[model samples]
Target: EKSSHLSAALLGEDCEISPEQLYELLQYAALGKHHNAAQPSWCHIYHQSRLAGVVVIVLHEMSQLHFYKFYLQFKHLRKVFRHRFTLPPPSANFLASLCGEGSGLNPQGTAPGLISTGAECIPKSSGLQCDPIIRKYGKEKRGLTSYTLTSEELRKNDYPMRDSPGCKGYMYTECDLQRTDSSPLFGLDCEMCLTARGNEVVRVSLVDAEGQCLLNELVKPESVIVNYCTRYSGVTRKMLLPVKTRLPDIQTRLKKILPHDAVLVGHSLNADLQALQMIHPSVIDTSLLFARNEGRRFKLKFLAKAVLGKEIQCKQRLGHDPAEDARAALELAQFFIKKGPVKILQRALKDVPLSTFSIIQFSLDPEYVASHRLVGFCEKVRNKLTDMLTIYAGPFEEDFCLKSVKKEFGKCGPIQSLTVVTETYQPYVCIQYGVLEAAQLAVESLNGAEVAGSCVKVQRPITAATLDCDVLIKELELDIENEGVIYVAGIKKSLTETDLQEEFSPLKDLETLFLPKDLQSGKHSTCCFLKFQKSQSAADALEAINGWAVKGSTLRSRHALASGHLWRWIWQMNHSSEKQGGNSLSEKMAPLSDSITASHLGTSLNRDILHKKELSAAVSSIATPQQLVMVPAAGGSVVLLHDNTFIISQGEKTGSDVLSAAQDGTKHHIFYQKKKYTDSTASGGFLMLFKGK
Candidate 1:
């Protein structure tokens, strides 16, 4: 009892319990205090007075929590009674030796030498805990069950990742993802050869969680082979001569081979997905799982030898065998899951050549991963909120040509359309791109660049609207339904809808043609939008007639990206008209009875061209008693309203006069001068003038 190794403080007021009491204390804490029970809630766990199993309960602390232990025994087979119990001192003390000397938990323990008590629940600097500083910024709380790579990890690895559907030429692994550790694991590896389009998959290998080969196939690249890359890929022309599988065929096969809940495991897995042109919903990148210093990933071969205690990718072989590499990766993931991170890190330290354990230590912090995810999410949001997809570039010293603008902005990315609005005092061009990155690049690189000896300011339009204009435009452009439609800008103003339909309908696969009209002007702009029955037809049209000269002007064609904006504007205008108790343009045109005059016939030639027939039909439907005869003055026409207020209409313009002729109590009469219009062009109607008496 007086051993020098045992400290005198441990024999003080604090009473130590036996190992059985310690277990009973943890069981009591886990079961919690449930009041008003006929029998103990934990009684079910004890069968015939023997502990069969346990129910694990997770606990969270908002404040300091302490647990005490007591023994419960049945008395006389009728009721239970609590035995005497003791609570530890308020300060930390070795309550009992729960772990043996060879327990191996001391290295990760909060107190290296003492038994871990409730004090271990309190976070320590050296222990693993969820960081609280950035908890509110996360979209969803991190759960222990999730094994897929975080958003930050996916971006850091440059994986072909997608959060939504409708991205062209990419297929998703699952329509609805089940993010849990229970999903099946599939190891994947790919080898690539250089091609005209860059790295393309030459071989792919897949293995299940048990290291059984599921698929191994050789693929042919669509682009011409530029380099065999045999040094690393081990692919040569002779080996691939008989291979008929291509990327699409591989994609189809992989889709069929993989289950809906499978989780892909690989080292630098994004590279393989990119080479194969596929997007997986769930993944575990071994590079991130076993991190190195400063975001640098250890070579797959290095990890295989260090962690698995087995050598891989021997120098004697020509290149790595994908099936072997895939199995190695699969085992590494299984090891990490079974042994946990702390034990794995401790084991890796001995074999690690590096002087410090900082590499694997940093990956253990959940906050680091969460922060990276927050940054990536913020970046995506900023891109979505950006309005730079369309830019205004103009006020040129001289009229600029389409070719010049195309040459300048096309360097950034593919342009969807270029609209030249010359009707204003200072002419400007609206440049629309198929993606936001191109528009951002243009804004940064060419915002103040000189064009035609003048500095043109390139920026987003200053107008604000209720919807995200850029997102709608880009989404509509990439939609499969709009693939065959092309937006033709700089069309000759002289051409009509009938002219456009006749010109394009003769082409193969032509379906429908649409000519959009300005909402305010009620006349077609110098643009034509047409849809072909097939997407190939639209591509062919662009090649054949994009720059062909017609009616003294050249046509510029691009895949349509902003048709939704036009349709929305038209709907809003029609809706507003209906709200004001006026007939909508789509329902019935506004009557021109108040402004149909000689001055309008000559001055407003192209004005309201789309509504001329509708207006005529509306006027003809008016009752004869409601019709009024009036003389067309040289400047405008005058109309007397029912309230005795007068309005003057000049051409397509109209204004009301506030003069109160009704206060004079005078009568007005209209008289026609037939002789005055005898030599004039007003043949159907006589010239009539009104005078108040």
Candidate 2:
């Protein structure tokens, strides 16, 4: 039926144009091609996703991407500006009225058709932050369980309608959702007003599967209503002060109306449930349901426009109509079911035998890919996973999923994606090996191996669109080779950043200096990092600082393994050295083996600054000879950290999640999970350095 409608809309009754011509017309419009023009001079390629739930067409011209992207963004910016400045506001009378279709209680209980007679709520088009044509891969069968219907189908269904007693009681009797089965599906929405404690629910709207209002009411709060939130909530002092409907009555009413097993659908459903103090197992949050991997959930109105091809939440003055919100959520659920379910949340337990969820979960979360630290690792892993391996059912009691494939060949090389289809009875696994040899090694070793009583079959599978994996791995690598970090410690307590910068402003290749402090650490020791554009300049400055003492501790510098790993060394400076006796770390100091070389350190200065006897005493320790040389390979540049440890990784082990979210995470540091930003000062402890004269 849909195909027929589309065909008629395109070809017309007499078939004015050929189907090939129609296809070309669409291509020309999409690619911004002109009539009678050959494809643009630039060489380009196009690919598309054949997934059932989503259709993604990707076009690429190595030379013209940025040019097109600029225009695309500019177009979106125009929409945002129009939405902000050009959208008309509603009249004062409409603003003061209740959001009900009746404008209040109606004798017939039939609310007016949506707020359309005077002012329509729909937008002219999509604005900034448009929903992408995205859908997750899953085993959902095409035959719809529910949420698919036409207006005729919905009217024919034997569900309750506006005249139904339950529907008659609601402010409006409209049903937008349709389900054939007796199993219950209800859409719930709530509007909250400011109360003494916080925001409290002032209105609730519940709609049945067919969108006939089951319940709609304004309830008085437990505490005094502080602000009506008249603009957004639409609830005014006039609606709640009379207190005709109390919280208890609404709670009791809902208990009787809502079934235990009914599937609840709503946007931001958690807040509604919390406001109601309701515990429900079956819920489909439209916000979460429509959430794609890269984009955040949309406002109900924006979502309606983008996904449902409808508009909502535009009437600002009439308090929010719960019935409208509920209908929107119910319809949104139907829209989600029409596409597919999100299965990413059902991740398998770590290292368990491969299940459907386990296969996709094996790859790092997209968050890891977005980080500077993991890009190189991702690139290396992708380069190795060029070959594919197929795992066919063998003597294994279970299906042919990664049953023992990983155990058998995980050592062969990194496995990038282990695609498994266990939902079907005939299960097969597609394994993308990080290295071609790894796949070959696995095929050679495991093809005839006996497992769970049967010998498993292994071979390579045909491949396509591996460019996705390539794109995944082709993120920016950390630029550590060209830059160096200086570890300056024992900064005077009295000095501010201005004082330190003034002293070190002459250093060449100086990029930024930052002071870091542990938010949880009460210790007041000052430490800072000096980042330089050139590694050689850092080396020269470190050499100079070693010969002269600043404040108290010797200044040190070293090439960072990567840009973001500075915090690991800073963590070591304050915590690790103290754990090991400070004296022991001082004893293994790399500089003690070399003689002082600074000509500026004249005799009188040396006597006052060097404190050789005190230094010797500080270096003395009862540790063994093997422990004496256990210094890190920074060439004795670590002035504060313990001498023995090597930074094996700067990942979860360092409690990076906690540190990166710390008070100074982005400002004193370089990044954020929510955003990427930088400043002149490095975040965290403070360090001081000298400018080159």
Candidate 3:
């Protein structure tokens, strides 16, 4: 019935055909006969000899038929015919013939109401059957088969009013192809913004499956005042300013360049497509493809890090570069293609064999479990067999030493391997047993036992086919015990030997002492040492002095009283007592002090000045060693004892005798208070360079 209505429409009917006539005509056509035994009472008055008038009358009769009843009958017949005939039903091919050379309706030309062909014409065949002549000469040859419907079919089928019949939700069908020769795999990256002007796109980049960049352009928005935080795009206002090219122009250029049926690859393609207002059917969303059942919230960078073992550092400033982003999206798509579809989280659980016999209790309350059992508990998690085991052991030990533990655990179970997680406060061990029973035994017996002196915990493991064992080994090698010793420089000048020694005395009791020697000649050097009694103490000391500062005046004043002055006065009084044959100076000078009035006191003061100046030039000019050597003192002010000692006086005036004695080493004697003292000044306990006589 549908075929008869289509045929009558093609014949340019003037009146509608009834349901009864249409059904009879279709039955007759299918049977390869024109005998209408049950024809409707709608015959036109026209002679067959006048074919044009007869054709017009037949068309007028067909046009008067009731199409609604005919449609219902056609649907019923389709089901009945399909059930009766074991052969495949005729498709759109039956209708194709009537419109083209394959149709047997065509007749020799010069006759009215018939199509005519010349020497170059292809012959027509029967409309109800596949015409051999037209099939050989008129079928579509080199190019893609046209899936487009004709105007008559469109009107009859109510096309263009509904969605395209061939389109699937997210997939492209052959009928949707706008280009035939190009590859279907491509990538897209877009930058969008909502500004004061309006919603607009800022940039778009395209890349092929091979990671070769194809198109990159900055699009100009319709208006300005670009908002910095343009949703998740990370495009800022500076990037949109003075926009490069008009958005519409860029879109037009892109449409011309891109294949209509290509698969679009991107991190979040839905967002990009929405931004660009592109309605593409074929798309590969990396985020969607890699999402775990844990949630639909997988980040692109995280997926890349886990799957590819490559870190992608996202730019924190400004707009994202279109070319780089597009390439990354393409790379992610390619990785998934090579690695196969990501396994669902629940499916990964199946890969991990559960131990039936060793049922361990897991608590959601970490604090309560930790306090009661003295053992840590992790939430029951679903991971690959290897990964779960690794995570289970991670709380007890480092991953590197897991092999040794695996060997020991294999005695109870057919252990394949093990992984220890060092991230937890307590060590965790994950064991992969060859059998589920062995895994059960291991988890039951070793869950709270100590392995290699550290508490051990057991669980299942996780595995990914693409996970690199060699990379894991490299990471394990870096987990060995590391001892770091940091050397710090740039100490303050005022820091004295005693100050440093006292500060680090606690450390010095633990390690050896090695002092730095000064290279230049000076009483003031910028370094000191606190030898630790132990190596660990050195580490502690280093931590303490990492940024310590010395505070106080560095230079001693010339006339100010100091501890050295009191010692010098006592030494003089002792020498004076020795000269008096054990008589105390307080008693000897007691009687003379009243009247004698010490006539040599003035001369003695002058002579002391001359001795000090002679010692200054020789002592201060001497060259010292390169390294500053700190000598440990018994108990006194931390003095920097140089090789040479030049006495430093606190008084403003210098005694003449002492000054002259300092200059002349030939006669090293000096007179003070009319007493003759031996020329023993050079013989005193002083740090000095000796000259061989």
Candidate 4:
């Protein structure tokens, strides 16, 4: 029946039996009277379990003796059951209950008695004597135990199934024990039942005094033949199937690598040790070391995040690297070591008032010197004078601030005092120069000076008033209409109002102008403001004069000068032009009525004849200043006049010229050209005229 079920399961046939039912059926058949009928009378039921592909049954015949019968169908389950049950002796009634027998029944029909069995053999009775050799060598003394054996001795000793002829357990003898001054330590990580599928150690790792490393290794399980969760571990059944090294072999290798006196270090080291079947007395679990509650229960990632400010996880693609994990664990251990186990335990106490007091005390301890030093330094910096500038020199250099200040400003005068402030932040020394001059010199010279790869800023002390004023000015300046109003000392003297008007005339119509006020008079009378007809005109005007200069006579020039002064007025009237917004006179004049008064005119010109009179005035203005003058392109048309010679003219349409000979060598002729006028009747009422001699 078992064979049939195994066949059905292997062939994927519809076996009517459920897994539980199949287990029961197998259990019944293995322990049933029909199967036990062939057994000898002296064979006492030692152990039984439904495991692998069979009913695992062990019979103790006599002293130092045990017989094992395994059904091949469940051979795999048997090994698994044996591993789980035999290590720590399983309950005597566990198998009986599984076989549908009452725990009260004595199946072997004999009272249990102690039997002396070596580590290699299974005890026949419940009262088994501990092996003296094992007790003497395996007992942990000074946190160390010796388990050394020669290759020949190891081959001769029986281990896994202690009584089995070929199996050998770890061997140790008193003669092999070596005492060392070094502290005992070990690292532990586990490949659990889930990870052990198909006999593979999918999750192998190590933990040490340093940390835990989730190493990558493939192990072949003796029971299962395939891996179901390959996507997670990146280990496939094909990759693991070929590697047949048993768990004992892997355990032996680990034991050889780890120091004998080393205490296991890990997050949950017990689980790992148990899985690997390593029996060690000394272990240091970081979980216990960092436990915040009843026991160490925090996840590894959580501990890493809270304590170390790092994120780590086993679910990552590369998985948890064992080396890094080991290192992290070790760091955590060291942190606890430095903090002291007693302090951590004290923190774990539940008394609210006591905990708070303890916390306060801890914070005030000398161990917090770095933090206190930083605070003190910041206080010193805060109390520094606002007018002074502070420069930070390289860290670890004493009196760096004072030294730098003296070195830079010592020649000028004796410094009041240079204060050096040192604190927690990477090394920096603050040097406060005594006076503003000294500070200014230091700032100008040392602001961006590099010392030991770090650039230092000579920072001016900030105060509430200064900071607020700066903020307000920055806000006001955001919409400053005139950047040209601001000036430097040497540049302001050369920039009179006339120069500004001449330069900015192309920007807008200059309706009014002002100049900067004199500081001595304490009046708003120096700077100028030329208001345009529109805000757009003003904006354009300001944009045009963004880079204009101001000429100043004094060493220091006030950039913020008041407007509407005499110098500015005279400059604007003499140097300003009506051609402010446009390039062509026609375009500029188009906005004005054909007949308009020039309010600021320098002459008594009639409104109707203003254009002709202004043209004559402009010509006279230029001509009167020169010996012989020619007014080319007057009023947008060419005009010429040689002294006492002729008045040559070229109109837009009618081409005409006039010439006059000199009346006297000392006197020049006054020639005039008059064109003939015609009436509306077009009857040639006037003719073109040129008067010349």
Candidate 5:
């Protein structure tokens, strides 16, 4: 039951999130980053076949619920989200430049090319600028194969060109004399599923020269379907079951939609033409256009990324999107025409040496930055109470019996405690479950369940006690305030502060101890507190002398409560190290505590005067921060924010540094450096950009 989570269990074995891990879960979903204390979120959920590295999360923002699809990029996919940095909206265009599209990194912010009259200029060739490409890949043949590959080349490369006597069902594209090289270049890519006869076209995507998709359709094969080829073709049985369009229908549409001499462009387009059982002249194959040494052809995706700096056909996708592939090929061909081979080679060579300089930068608006800070702050607070297992449901009818409520909700899971509260105007019941899952299950399943013929709403309880439970429990743990302090009771009324210090000094490295005395009689109380130099020494004293007899009475020794005057004094001493003007804060704490203690003497005689002065002196002797304030951010994390700078620490044990500023009066920048240390947010360096004011 402890292993079960309502949302995670639905995702199958690829994900298993416990209640305590909910904070990190939301953080990963929101920020696309791994938690400092948890493994990368992709490690758990990326392997699911149904999800395909993409998870849909329901987010509530602007008073509306929105469904967002977050893709978890594999570790080796790219360095886009791997780095640690923050960006604001204004500097979004900077990302385009880093990806080699804009002029941000270019000299004088100019596009890379042969600049003439302050604008890029390219040599023209018959108004097409493709004369060099045509001269290299052979001229289009006039026989059955109207494309570039010759008879011998077609046989060697396994291209599907039906040029022999057995070609009966083939068709040819119509020709129009009005079409020329300047006609809109259309990029074509097809996906095939293995049919009993052979590989048949299942999906076809075509894009115009402007990268706008003109035709994207899924077709059912004429022959009996065999393998859907979901991995490469991205076609599943469920998808094609509803598709009624067939190959002949698609062929007729393409023949009419094409502008006769429209330059049909693709990568290894002969295969696509063969799959469609049609012949088209005036076609450009990027495979042959960007030819390699000894007829070696690179993949269309590889060529697109290398030449155009565009990433396509990533492994994270369920299968290739023919539209995206067609667009990539079109852009690749367009780039070769615009920049030519020589500039392309130079840019590729220049980019190789600068590949190590991978830092995503963007400018952010001030409001956007502040909003992110608030989000982080809220996440920290949510992380602290992830383990709470209580819920409240209420304002039920006054006559609603407790038995009826228990019988209704107890069906969900085991209940630890159920209390009926009727002190307020409306009555309600508080329920604490034995496990977090049970509590969650009760809230989700039994929220609107009827009890005593009346509907009841179940939800997490909101109360002062529940909200402060973690902080109150944290006081009992060994922290700076309660590290070396022990409480003792059953002391004789005659014992003074010096006498108790002398009695316990030999036991360990004694700092100072506190013994409250009555202000009216100035007599010591029956209990006193002890402070040691080390936590271990205090623990040892507590264990060794807890039951020891003191003045013929058994002494009750335990760790001191971290709240009350002692904790406040220790906290002040730690922060009072910094001196304002000429005096330290410790110098200012004595009179303040003394005046408060004197005014409260009538209410409680347990306010110590002599011992507090000694403890304050001992604490001042130790080194502490000059000024410090810790605010809890998302997931109960400590963050320091001042002006334009933000710093976040893992906890008291470790920290990471992030620096940001508006620089040069035009650009905003953020730089993060994660130290090579454990318990840090992450380990890496990033340079970011934001929009400036």
Candidate 6:
């Protein structure tokens, strides 16, 4: 009616606007003129069912609405502002001036009629300034809904770095996890049963405003259920044996309860929607609300606990509570409306000198920090004061992963870290950035770029967003000294640590190697780390050995970051012996052969490398005498991650006793024994096997 009344005032009687025109005008008013006038606008008209709340209606800051009391010329305009236009009641002089009644001849050669000013007029400059009071009490009206949807670019659908369309007053977008102000909002959750065709909806819990149960039912599937799937979906055979509501019947009731255009809220709504076989465009999926990336979704339970300070879907004794899950999803959305955006705004605009733009980046990942150069770069750069960026991309194929994201995004600018947001159909890479320049560059250049076989969608971290300052900050801190490490990927299962030691011999500088294997299956990892004594040596080795084919597969290689917890690794391995436990770490690693021999030149080392005599002995027992190849060590020993393999120099080798006795006099020595490379640590953490002494 506001649009219609205003349109009638401006155009003429019967000059009514279609929902389309009203949206475009609203978009022009709220968001600056942009394309997609109808689809993405901020101006919204609600039905009578919706309770009016403050809505932020933006006008061009340079427009007359900023200074003159032109809004008062039309009574309908006054109603749009909730009758709280900032202009003060106009003086006779001001009204006369507008009509040229006092200053000049009127067009009709007569005095103009009286007009009243709404409120005090305040001047504006270039930027937007919101009317807080009016915004607080949004347009309280009903019937015929339409809003100008802003361009997608202005939207911060990213995590911690979410983008937003520049309107100060609280704004709600689709799937925003925003609390609804009574527009027939509903939270829906469904449970499924496994059938021959696939997953079929068996139960549903729907809630409405005031937490009222709108519809809760057990719907019988079309076909017999193959599995009750009771572990997660609490439905049981006994419960469904009784006459249950047919799916069509339930759908009928659901449609009656739901407005055709009502907003539906849930977690991973894609799954629920598919199970129910329903199509809803205005869905607020909590998974996307707290997404790791485009296709990555957080479990409803996670968001509830983290955002809403509540737990849901935890109790399985009674079965999955659709009500609990649905309410949890609803509450998460509410929490975002109440607090999520403010914090996201603050973090996303970290470079801005405002308290609202502050971020505590104390604990970012090291690799992330180095990759994005966050330490030296301004945290973020926006084309406007507000432009949330997503530092992730995805829907990639097998050839795509963290490395692929970094490679593509690196061309644009710095990146903190990139992680694959694993999904069945699409795998996305979630990234954190140290600087905005790089993020922006990446978003612009790589958003639609092809990655592997998929056309990747790169943008701000939405479902993949992070506001946990400590978590991201910690991850951003690099392992400073790990420059000497080299990543070796696609390791052949048939290859052993001894094989790698030989392959890596081209770079003579030696350091510990990290090659963990599956203990139960005794399968070698397809990736490992080879740390060189000199950083330059690691680089050299990477150049020499990258893509080297062995055992029917080519190995991939790259520089690896040193671990931040190197000291912790050393401490644990060194202390493993003294720690009095029946099943200690040393035990977890298979003990060496009893009858071992060693050349005076060689020594023994364990999983962590450079440990005490006890660990050394355990390492010695595992290796054959010819396997020992001594590298210079300062006093005790340095952890050598790579296993040793050297043909005995046709020289005499000694037994363990002789080797132990000759240890003090050795220049270089050999050790002998045999053990499989596949092994594990006592605590369940995996560690690769190697020979060192």
Candidate number of the best TM-score:
1
Query: Mind giving the per-residue lDDT tens digits that candidate 5 earns over 494-598?
Result: 766666776776787766666654334665556666667678998999888766776675665666543224222322223433422323222322212222211
Kindly report which residue stretches of model 4 are placed more than 4 angstroms away from their true locations once superposed. Answer: 1-184, 193-200, 207-216, 225-234, 241-244, 342-693
Candidate 1 per-residue lDDT, tens place, 199-268, comes to 9999999999889998988899999999887867777899999999988998888998898877899988
After superposition, candidate 3 runs with Cα above 4 Å error:
1-175, 178-183, 197-199, 230-239, 313-317, 342-693
Q: Mind giving the per-residue lDDT tens digits that candidate 2 earns over 454-572?
A: 56687654345233322322211112222355545445556677777877787887766755444365332344556666778887766665435555533433333212222322233
Measured with C-alpha atoms, the lDDT of residue 52 in candidate 2 is 13
Give the range where candidate 3 is weakest over 10 consecutive residues by summed lDDT.
555-564
Q: Give me the candidate number with maximum lDDT.
A: 1
Clashes of 2: 27
State each model's C-alpha RMSD to the native. Answer: 31.0, 27.8, 40.0, 39.1, 26.9, 27.7
- In model 1, which runs have C-alpha deviations exceeding 4 angstroms? 1-144, 163-167, 175-177, 353-693
* Candidate 6 off by > 4 Å: 1-182, 291-297, 338-340, 343-508, 513-693
Q: Give lDDT tens digits, candidate 4, residues 558-579.
A: 1222112212322222232222
Candidate 4: residue 658 lDDT (0-100): 27
Question: Candidate 3 or 6, higher TM-score?
Answer: 6
Report how far residue 664 has shifted in candidate 1, in Å. Answer: 99
lDDT of 6 by residue, 103-164 (tens): 34342431121111111110111211222211322333222122111233113332111232
For each candidate, what is the lDDT?
A: 0.52, 0.42, 0.38, 0.36, 0.50, 0.44
